[model samples]
Target: MGQLERATEATLARGARLVHAHPRTLASVVALSLACFGAAAYGIAQTAPDASDLPRRLVTEIVAHEDLPSQLEALAGHELQLYRSEQTRAGDGAESLLARMGLVDAEAAAFVRRDPLARKLIEGRAGKLVRAAATPAGQLEELTARYAPANADLAGTHFDRLSITRGADGRFTARIATVPLATSVRLGSGTIRSSLFAASDESGIPDAVAVQMAEAFSVDIDFHRELRRGDTFSVVYETLTADGEPITWNHAAGRMLAAEFVNKGEAYSAVWFKDESGRGGFYGLDGKSKRRAFLASPMEFSRVTSGFAMRMHPILNQWRAHKGVDYGAPSGTPVRAVAQGIVKFAGRQNGYGNVVEVEHGNGKSTLYAHLSRIDVRQGQRIDQGVRVGAVGATGWATGPHLHFEFKVHGEQVNPLAIAKSSEAIELSPAERQRFAGVAQQIRGQLDAALTVGATVAE
Candidate 1:
């Protein structure tokens, strides 16, 4: 017989002898094979170092449950792969992620961008990926990258493939990771009779978030007298990393929900948008433009109780034109940040109360007056809605309301009409595909999460 035939006969005879001697071993092997059929790899981690043309990676999360009454361990297996570059960023990344999903590069990214949460994942950027087999706990896996670095001669970085996969099951592949693509937080509602701030105190929105929400909508509404009762809001934002912390929110983002002035007869609803051209604006419920050429009222819910015209000045009784607007509210009524900018002046002024002036770029500066206190300092960077101070009759004010002013460069202008605007966050054409792929993958995770209880931890 040929060498192959002789070897086959010998192997079969040995197996038959062993099976006759130990019947239980054969039964156990057959049972295990059926249990883990397509879910298990035979020579996976045990592949010889010299072997090439390796099989594709394993995809599965091995979720363990302590409560299930079965004696056999429950197997929660799902496959996933995420690549980070045009070459590697497929599977879980966009073009790269889609490529990993066994799709053509172009198709993967298109799918991801079609969803909102997926577009957000590319923005959230944890910068690493996960691929698992036989486990639900995210296991760390080794990965590859194309770091197109410029050098003296070479114009692009080369690809470096590395791996760090987990052996057994648990969360995190044994490697460094990128942040997840999206983030969310739950909040409760509250009622207010006076202002949004008072109502926010009763809601779960921290003062910081409350301030930002007001600032985001300041272009359209006045918060001081506008907020009455049952006003509500929700946001979906960026995730950033300062040190080691996984950030939950970044201001360069979009918000999905907001409501206000229901206590009054008037009601307003809007979705904030930063368009692809980098212009930020507001859209009303009908998607009609709520944005005037210039944004009206630097702070929302704060009104133009005092207008830009001739008046008997409150402190200096003279028929002089009031160059700005006065926002009438109670003392210690926390003042809002009118727009995204830097603090240029945060101290006493000639006749203004504990004033805080902000430079909103493009030569625009807004001033807040009649403060019981100042919360920001000179040269400090603050956002649009952060509280700069509490209102009080400080400098030359007859009452608690704040004297607000808007200026262009050094010249004074009406605070109701700021014309220049800031840009919004967007994805480039190349990035769009990548963004979409990531969203699709996350949708898969979301689907899985919905099917399986997160109470799996329970």
Candidate 2:
């Protein structure tokens, strides 16, 4: 035999002898040998050279790109002609609003006024989007108005849709429908640099939302006076959408569910909650309503021309205790009633000139002086923030300004100081329990929103 054949036979003979002497040990050795042989074979295969250019096979097919049909392109052009918008003013009538919407169809206007269903589209609440599709020649073809019902679930989860379409025969059909809208909570946090609106604009929050936020906390925080440069605010509110598109911010009827404002290192929070009676109001975490008996000022936002202190009278030219605060505004500015009360007086009063006094419960009352016109009658009941008169320089003043006074038990107390002590309405025992649950849920959402805002900011 050759040398290789002789070696193989010799190795087999040695293993057979070991098996006969120690069978278990010989079996283990045989298994180990087989394992090593498999590993060596695998290593050799891995180290083998790649057959990159070994052989070549080719297969080809032709594919053609399809172009959009001309009809489809025309349809898209028509769709682009659809005019979409939101109702801007509460005083806008069907004619004005339709004209603004570029719908010059007089028949549409008549239908809106006469048909109840069509009237719903035209005369319903403002702050809703009204869409119109017109022919290339500017003739109205279709119109749609969408708004949230007062009872819409959880802020913008539903929308009431009104559709008006012109038939091919020139007849108009109107119908009302409900559409499901996607609801999402958006969080925005802003630090004031110059003004609230400015900060809101910088933070991507709408000015309307910013105004609402200020109103929500106005009882405790004077946006005009108390706002500081570094004051921060975090807001969590609702946004409604359809077909993955969000509605206009003006028409977004969602409430500010939660808000946190850190002014001068003091934190204030407001959470929206509805009691058992379905009365919804903003309350603190402890279930105290943020609504005070009076707003800090008669105006929503204005600069203080003069404070409630001794100042030289422009007309008298003598130093006297200014019983009320003066807010500088234009002459036709609408003055607001500071509190809910009967119109105690609504006319001129010597140096006070055109003035209105409203007496409230607890022997409290407010006085608004210096007016160009009076809108209330004596003994007529009025609510807070109602237009009492217009700002004018009719009183003993050099310019148009509102002189506001707060009286408690017939004695004048600085309105600013009284506003600080304005009482808050506390929820009842049962109401408090319900509010706690709602508060807890809102708290969780606020935290998540704040975290998301922080991440985006980073």
Which one wins on TM-score? 2
Per-candidate clashes come to: 56, 0
Candidate 1 accuracy as TM-score: 0.35
| lDDT for 204 (candidate 1) | 36
lDDT of 1 by residue, 202-266 (tens): 44344554555565455555565466564544332222222222222333222333322233555
Give the lDDT of residue 409 in candidate 1: 79
Residue 147, model 2: Cα distance from true site in angstroms = 8.9
Residue-wise C-alpha lDDT for candidate 2, range 167-221, written one tens digit per residue? 9899999987777888767888888899998987878876656867887788778
> Residue 146 deviation, candidate 1, in Å?
55
Summing lDDT over every window of 10 consecutive residues in candidate 2, give the lowest-scoring window.
242-251
